[model samples]
Target: MELIEKHEEILERRAELLEQMESRREQLKIQRTKQVEKSEAARHRNITLLQDLQKIEDRLRGRQLPRPHLLALETRYWASVEQSVPAWEHFLLGKGPHPTDGPGQPPRRTKQTPSTAKGSGLPPRPKPRTAR
Candidate 1:
């Protein structure tokens, strides 16, 4: 039950933080004309992640929520629980849908083979055999 309570708390906190963060972002946009939106975006993004963390933390707390009911969830995602908790944990607990497992890295780009186009810098491949 402590897990549920913590989840509730985290969900609540996440909502509040997201709301404030977004509002601040909007304010920054309206207030600052063109100096730098990057900083504001970065700030809001950080807060947004923190909110997510709260949500996740709540999930770790789970329905049991004993002394540290979250331990299970922590073990499940030991390295990741601290990430913005709310949104993350919410998803973790949800039934509708969830993100897929980790994606492997994209295939590394190899050197492009030389094409027939003029002035191409790539080395040419050996000629292919022609049909008799």
Candidate 2:
């Protein structure tokens, strides 16, 4: 009779442990679902904000305004170019290379013909013998 009671106690403990494990598993599932929903909401909010910013930028571009200082600066730049036009033409027509092609680039090397051929007069190298 005592043995039967001990076995029943162990079986009851096992059933309680299984029930607790199942409950914990369900709670974890619920937490994961909540996290996913929050992430999706954040993504949607970011997209909406970016769209609103783009709209504001488009409106600003459509109604462009000219400032007086910028116009003055442009006029001065063009006037200086016009004043120096004759000097620029003289430099371009000069015999030296253009200033734009500065000495920064390396000079190209030319390929030489084989020295042993025909009128080169150099001795030819011997060919290596192959083993059988």
On lDDT, the leading prediction is 2
lDDT, candidates in the order shown:
0.69, 0.79
The TM-score of candidate 1 is 0.25
Among these predictions, the greatest TM-score belongs to: 2
Work out how many backbone clashes candidate 2 has.
0
- Tens-place lDDT per residue, model 2, 1-132, is 999999999999999999999999999999999999999999999999999999999998898566889989999999998987775575456533443454886533223467526455556768898998
Candidate 2 error regions (>4 Å): 1-3, 66-132
> Can you write out model 1's per-residue Cα lDDT over 18-58, one digit (the tens) per residue?
99999999998886765467687888999999999999998
Which residue pairs overlap in candidate 2's backbone? none
